[model samples]
Each structure stands twice: as structure tokens, then as C-alpha cells.
Target: MFEKILIANRGEIACRIIRTAKQLGIATVAVYSDADANSQHVKQADEAIYIGESPASQSYLQMDRIIQAALDTGAQAIHPGYGFLSENDQFALACEKNNIVFIGPPVAAILAMGLKATSKALMEKAGVPLTPGYHGTNQDADFLKQQADGIGYPVLIKASAGGGGKGMRLVERGADFLGALSSCKNEAKSSFGNDEVLVERYVMNPRHIEVQVFGDSHGNYVHLFERDCSVQRRHQKVLEEAPAPQMAEAKLEVMRQAAIDAARAVNYVGAGTVEFIVEQDGTSYFMEMNTRLQVEHPVTEMITGQDLVEWQLRVAFGEPLPKLQHELHIHGHAIEARVYAEEPEKGYLPAIGKISYLHYPEQNQNVRVDSGIVDGDEITTYYDPMIAKLIVWGKNREAALVQMHHALGHFHVEGLGNNIAFLDRIIRCDSFKHARLDTNLIQREDEFLFKNIQKANAQLIISAAFTALLSLFKQNITANNPVWQAESLWRLNISNSYPIKFKLDDENILVNFSPVEHGFIAEYQGQNYQVSGTLIDQNSIHIEIDGKKDKLAFSQNETALTLFSNAQNFKFAYIRPDFNTDDSDSNDHNLKAPMPGVITKVLVSANDHVKKDDVLLTLEAMKIEYSIRAPQDGIIAAAYFQVGDQVKAGDELVEFQVLAEDVA
Candidate 1:
């Protein structure tokens, strides 16, 4: 066992590794970038070292700095949790050269599985079932198009060295192949510095099931069962569950054995995952192997009751497998939802801002939250936008779904956009509840998942009004004053009516509140309701409206007030009647950056004519590329930013002069 280990990663994974290290009586060292100087992982580690600037290229990906940090801290082993240098073969080799243990698979295993093309070829040789497509190494665009044409339409062009949904595109027709191929290769070059790509048949309605396989240097290997990661958006996983619902025991054993064979073929050591795309008929095809701990590994942990990080440490220390295949069994069903700080309604664009208020569900044996952020921490464009992961376990899949829905409902985030409500909808939706899942589940269930089932009705209006008034009253109360003085507003015999206005999305709401004896009468939409509210805590309010009681979680900032009820979040902006709110000068003809990012491509110049839907520029943020398009046929009046320019949300990227006849 290592006396001390250094985690060459940040955020929740790094923090997660440290907790297990501490439990094992091993001191842990944390490496941080400028952005994560005061992050939760930094505060939790036994020792901390500054690595470099905020950008991952200058920090986490700087293998030398991370290795040096491990050496300086006297760390016997370095754990590269998940991203960054986790699967980089050179990093593993470098650790071996420095006599420091890399708590992961051998460099040989990493090299074998590093590229999708090579890994698929190797898997085929190992007798693992593979998808029917081209995995050969011809990088020519015409050659790739021909392969795609032969494979049929709707082929997936994936970056050979990609993971995390980057550098991948789906072309539905031969005409669109070249363009999609170009974008895919550009992203691959930008993200992995490898432009090589492979064409695969895009499996429709496929379920992404991956087996968790672990091996020790002693030639011992075991599979920890599987996780279904089919619920996805933008080819990225949103929800994952263990023991994959509806899989037969016989079929599972075959996949598990295949996974073990994959590990054995590479002489793999430490933790790795073999992913497969499962069809509706139960047939499965080999995807790629991830040679590190996955983001959703907690789901497996909950079901197996084993600390995978601890296993990694033991394996790296040359210990034998902790448990044989027969000894390990699944205890229950577990599911994990990735809570991201992004707007689901706005094409899931990453949101950046300080977390003014953050509340997670109370964790117990049934619910767990893994996060590396606290209140006042900012979500920046420099890193992934995942705020936390909420994992829940239950005796069965249905029970787990129920737990996850409730857990997601209890989550509240303010000061930026988030996907808490979206996640809840996913768990509660009929398709997910019935176990009808696929990689395109999100798209198929889009209407229900993004539905506005609940709105600001009279009950909600009264609750919001009473809570707002009580919050103000509590703020005005002081230690030197009697509480009755603060309560005098209700004591007055006269009914003083206060008119409050709020904006929910695009709808405007008006409510009138009049003081009464025990509560206030709220008039909304020409209906009156008696309302009273008590502050349970800073983030919660217990309210009664018209003899019915409800408890709501709420958070307020300078601009918006948010309320969470019935598994949905309603964010309302206060409409001050006295303020002049005219947007006559605001130009709809101008194209603006939807979020903060760095401009990577400027496809249009000033005075250039462009059709509607033409790509004007491309911005890269949080490792995702977003194309800014012309909203209408117009002539570009000005292109404000060039390639490589940094932009903030709503910064004008291009000004357009639209045809006057088309304006109306």
C-alpha cells in the first residue's frame, strides 16, 4: 500500500479518490490549477500543489508538472482520475520511468485502447463482437466518404482518439458526409491533436452498456457487471444505471466474459471499462474501452459495495484481486444523474457564474452526491460544466427510479442555469420508468422532458408573494427591536394592498397582496386566496394557501427568484414597475455569442452576404464547439471578433443588415 498518493486531477473525482485514500490511512496530495485554487478538492487534501494556469493544456495536461508535483510531495503513486492524463500512455510510461506508480492500467493496455480505430481492430482480433464499419487508417476525406457510402447513410464519424462526446458527428446522407467529416476532423485535431477518424454505422435506438472490468498484475481479472448509459444528449451520457435493466443473466455473462477477455488480451492492470452498443434484439457490438475510472463509476460502486478507487490503489501496489468473480454479486440497482450547470432549454449551452446558492438532497444510504464545488464557487468555461453527480440506490430498478426522481427534485441551484429539473423529468418520464431506454431516448422523449406541465397558478403566486414579503420582513427585523414591531404590518386594521409583478420566462404575472390578521389575501388572475408563509431555512419556505399547505425550496439573487416545486424549477425575474424597460434600440439583426467562449473560427467577414442558417463563426467553450449562424438572409455589417478572440455571453459577434421587406 502506498503511504502517500498524489491525485493528478481536480473536481469531484480527485476529491472522491482522496476520501478513499484517507480511509485507507494514506495521505493524499492534490494538484490544482489557477481556477481551482480554492476548490473543494484542494481544501480536502492533506497537501496541495499549484500546477499551472487555468487552461487544462497548461495545467492538468502538463504531464511533467503533475509528475513533478508528485515527486515534490513524495507521493508514491499518482492517480489520474478520469480525464486529463488518465488514459495518456506517455504519462503512464513516464510514471514508471520516475519509479512512481501510476494508479491505472499499464502503458501497453493504454496504447492498445487509446485510439478507437486501433481498439476496434484489436477487439475484433480478441473475438469481441464489433460493429460493421471501417476502422482502417486512411485519413483521406474522399476515402472516408466512400467508406461511409458503402456503410450506408447515417454513419457515425468518430475521432480515433476521442472520448467524452467530442470529435464525433453523424451524417445522415452522402451529400452531408464531407462537411460533417471536416467538422469532425477539426474538432479531433483541436481536442486530441489527432485528426485521424473512423467511420461506424450509427446504431439507431441503441443502448450504451459498458462492463466494469478490473485486473491485477498477477493475471487475475474480474468483471463488476455492467452499467446502462443509454440516456444521452449530444452523444454524452446523462443518466446511467447499474446491472442494466432487462438484460438476461445468460446474455450478461457472455458480455462480462467478453470484457474479461478484452482485459486479458491487453494484459490490462487496474480499472478499465469495455463499452458496447446493445440493439433492441439483445445483440451487442464493441465500442471503445476507457482505460480509467469513469465519471459514472459510483453507480457500479453502489451496487457492488466496493470502493473502486481503493481497488485501483491495491492493484497498482501489485496486490492480488480483492474478490474472485464468484465472490462478487450485485446487491441492488443504482442510478446516477449528472447535474450540469447548463441551460437545457437553450440547446444545453454551458452556463458560467458564481454559485450563489447550492442545495443538494440529504444523502443517506439510498442517495449520494459527489461534488467538488461549494457556494460562491464559479463555473467557468475553462473546464467541464458538470456541477455534481447525484447517485441513488434501491432494492430494484423501479425503486431506484423513484429515489432518483425525488433526489433530483430536492436539488436546487441558483445564480446560473442548471439541469436539475431536466434530470427529474427524465427519471419520472414514462419511457425511463418503463425501462425503454436508448442513446436517443432524450431526443425521443424531448416533448415530455422539456414540457411546462406546471405553471405559476394561483397557488404558486400566493406562495411566492407570501414568501417574498416574509423574507423582507425578516431582513428588516433587528435584535434591538421587538418582534411585534416587525409584525405590525399585519396588525394594521387597514388593508394595504401591494401589487407585485414578475416574469416567468416570457409570461408576465401580476399579483396583489393585502395584509390580514393571520395571513394575507393574494389576488391573482381575478381570484383571491389566503396565504401565509414561514421560513424553514434560508433555502426553504413552508407556505399555506387557501387551507392547503406546501413546502417549497427557493433561492433569490439580485435579479431572479427561483422556486422548486413538484419536481420542477420556476425562475422568475422581478418586474419593477418604476423601471423603464424598453428594448427599441436592441437589434435583432445582430448575432451574439450565446455564452462565454473563445472564438475558434470566423467564417464570415464584414459586408459578406450570407443566407439564413449560414455559419458565421464558431466558439469553443467547455470543450464543446458551438456554431453561430445567421438568423436571416443579410449582409454582414460588421464582424466584431476574429478567430481566437475571447467573448462573453451576449457579446455581439456580427452585425447584419437585413432586407427591409423581410424584417416585418
Candidate 2:
């Protein structure tokens, strides 16, 4: 084993690699950009080095900086932790040239498997079943459209070098093929520095299952069963499980063998995943292969009792396979939910803000949290918004589902948009419980998953009132205010009514309360209730409302107070008596950026006419592209920012002059 190794990545995966390296008595060095200077990975590693600025192009993807950092730190090996440079064949070859061990597949294997077009052709030659589509090197738009026409409608245009759901578009009609192809190519070029693409027949009602395959320098190989990653949103996985439920032993064995064969075809070494798109009838077709560790590898680790990172290290050190195929066995069922800082209701738009408060379920043998963030960390737009992964294990699939539901209920966040409630709903929904999963599960279960936002009920209202009261009381006592005492002496043994106001998602709420012996009596909307609670800690309270007692969790920030109850979070802003509302932009005839991002394309010029829903511009943030469209038939009065300009949320992008209703 190498004595010291540098993790050429940041965030959770980099921190994850550091953990395993330490257990093996190997020193770990961490490289960070400006954004991650205080990140958990940097704090955990034995040594840290600053590579460059915050953006990946300026830092993480700077191969020379990373390589030099590893050499300066005296690291004998470099672990590219699954993103940025993990699957780059050139990066792997660079490591080989530097004589530093790259803890991944060889350069030849990476080149052969890195591009989807190349891999599919190689798989076809190796006798691995492949999905019907075009995998040629032709980049002509008209040629690709003809191929899409040949394959029929509903074809998927995927970036040859894309992964993690980037640079992929599904066209349902021949007329939409050319436009979708252009968008896909642009995204591919922006994401992978490659405009090359492949068109494939999009499999309907498909379940994504991928097998874990490993190899060693000695030419030994083994299969680590499979993981089902069918529950997805926007073509990206949201939930994953190991020892895929509902798969027959015979079919699983066949898939496992096919995975090993795919590995041997490339002479693959280290950890890799062979993905397949399984139809409803159980026929599996090769989709693509990831040449590095997967984000959801924890589920496989939980089920198989294997440390895949350690395996990567061992194999990179030229060790033989840890266990033969026959020796490996799946233990219990495991599931993993990716907890991201995004809003499920708002098209899963990535959120960027400071994580004012963060709380997670307690971790133990059965429940695990792999994260690189602590309280007070910021979720910026520079990197992926995944906060942490919640992985749980149980004796069976049913039990694991139950555990996952419970764990999600306990997860909480504040100061940004999050999908904790959405994840909890997914685990509790009937379809997921019954394992009726597919790539379209999120869309299929839209009604249940994206239920209408609920207003504050009596329980939540009283909880908020009492929580605010107690919080103020604590502050008074802490500051040694003589007027406030624990005995209610401030009221002179007489109960006096007080008014508490709050703003709940733009709606104002007012509650009147009178101090009582044990708690408080409150009135709201002509209903009176008994409300009392004591602060359990900074973030929790034990309350009794109208004779019903419960303990709830909450987080209070400078601007808002959020209560976590019923598996959902309710945010309340303190509405002062003199608070004023801001409606300055209500009638403004301008389009604003919904989120902070860099402008990639300005499709409309000042004074240009555009129809409603016309593509006006495009913005890229967090590796995803969003098209800004015209809201009505209008003439563009002004286009504020040009391509490559950085804009914050609510920044005016274009001003428009709407046409009169009677205008011809």
C-alpha cells in the first residue's frame, strides 16, 4: 500500500476517500479551491493545498495544478473521486506519465469506455447486448436527425462523454429532433468539452440497474451483485437500492456475468459500474459504463460489507482481487437517498445559499451519513448541491424502506430550498413501497410527490407561537433582563394578552396569547387553544397544545423560524408590527433570472419581437442549463446582460414591451 496519497477532488467523495485511506494507515492530502477552503474535506485531510479559484475550470479541472499539488505533498498516488477528473482519460494518462499511481482504471480502459459511442461499439463486438441506436462519430446535425428518424420517435440524444444525467435530451417527435440535438450538443460541449453525441432509442418504462465489477493488476475479477437506480428526477437518480428487489436469481446471475465480460473486454482494473436499462419484461440492454466509483456506491457497500474505496486502493497497489466471484455474497438489503439542496416543487431548481441550520438523523450501524458539510456551510452555485447521502440497511427490502422513511423524516434544513420532504414522500408513497419503480417514477407519481403546499394548521400555528415566545424568553434571561423572570412575576400573577405575528409564505398570521401557569392560552381565527412548550435545546421543543403533547424540531434564523413536523417543514418569518411589504416589481415588464447563474446564450436582441414561450436566453448553473423564455408576445426593450455575464437571482435579464390585445 502507498504510504501517502492525495485526493484530487473535493466535497463528500474526497472526504470519503480520506477516511478509507486513514484506516489503511495512508496519509491523505486534500486539494481545495477558494470556495472549499473551510470545507470538511480540507479539515479532515492530513494536509491541504490551495489549487485555484472557486470555479471548476479554474481549480478542480486544472490538471497541472492538481498534479503539482500531489507531487509537492509527496503523494505517491492520486484518487480522482468520481467527478471533475475521475473519468478523464487524459488525466489518467497524465498520472501514468508522471509515474504517480492513479487509483483508477488504466488509460487504455478509460479511453475505450469513456465515450458512449466507443463503448457501445466495443460492447457490440464483445457480444454484450446493446440498445438499438446510432453510435457513429458523425457530428453532422442533419445526419443525426436522419438516424433519429430511422430509430423512430422518442429517441434519446446523449453526450458521448456525459454522466450524472448531463448533456442528455429525450425527443418524442421527429420535428423536435434537430432542436433537441442542438441543445444536447451545447450542453455536452459545456460539460465535457466534447460536442460529440449518440442517438439511441429511448426505452420506455425502464428500470436502471447497474452491476458493480472490480478487477486487479493480476487479471482477476469479481462481481459485487447489483444496484437498482430506477427512481430518478430529470434523468438523475434520487434513490437507489442494492440487491435489487424483484429480480430473479437466474436473471441476476446472467447480468452479473455480462458485467464481468464487459470489464474483461476493456481489461478493466479497479472499481467500475456496468449500467443496463431493464425493460418491464426483464430484458436488459447495455446503456453505458462508468469508469470510476459511483455516487451511490454506498448502497452496494452496505449490502456486500465491502469498502470499495479500499478495493480501489488495493488494486491500484497491484494487489490481486480481494475475493473471487463465488466467495462474495450479499448480506442485507440497503437503500440510499441523495439529499440535495433543491426545491422539488419548483422544477428541482438547484438552491444556492448559506445553510443556516442543518440537522440529520443520528448515525449508527444501521443508518449512515456520508457528508462533507457541517453547520454554517454554504451551498454555492459552484458545485453539485448534494448535501449528503442517507443510507440505511435492514434484513429485507420492506424493512429497509421503513428505515429510509423514518430517517428522512428526521432530516431537516433551513436557509435554502431542500428536497427532504420530497424524499420522505417518495419512501412513504405507495409506488415506492411496492417497488413499482422506473426512470419516470417522479413524473408518474407527481400528484403525490408534489402535493399542494399546506397552510399552517392549528397545531403548527400554536407550535410556532409558543416556540417564538420561549425563544424570546430565553434571550431575555440570557441577557440578564430583570423585568423577565421564570416565575411569571413580570405579569404580577395576572395573565395579560400579547399579540404575535408571523409571515408564512407571503400570508400573514396573527395569534393572541395569555401567559398561563404551565403554558399559554392562544386564540387564532376565533379558536382558543392551550399552548405551552419548553425549549429542549436550541432546535427542539416539547409542547402541549389543547391537552395533546408532542416534541417537535425547529430552527430559527435571523429572518425566519422553521418548524419540522409531519415530515414537512413550515417556515415563518417574524412580522413586526411596523413591517411593510415590497411589491415594487409586481407590474415590472421585465424577465429576471430565477437563480444565480452565468449567461450562456442570448437568443434575443434589444427591440426584437418574440412570441410567448419563445426561447429568449439560456443560463448555466451547477452544471445544468435552463432556458429563459418570453412570457408573452412582446418586443424586447433591452437585453441587460450578454453571454458569459454572471447574474444573481432576481437580476433583470431582459425588458419587454407587450403588444396590445387588439394589435394584429
Prediction-by-prediction clash tally: 0, 0
Query: What's the TM-score of every candidate structure?
Result: 0.96, 0.96
Error of 2 at 468 (Å): 0.9
What's model 1's overall lDDT?
0.89
Model 2: how far residue 194 lies from native, Å: 1.7
Candidate 2, residues 261-326: lDDT per residue as tens digits?
Answer: 999999999999999999877789988999999999999999888999999999999989888888
Judged by whole-model lDDT over C-alpha atoms, candidate 2 comes out at 0.89
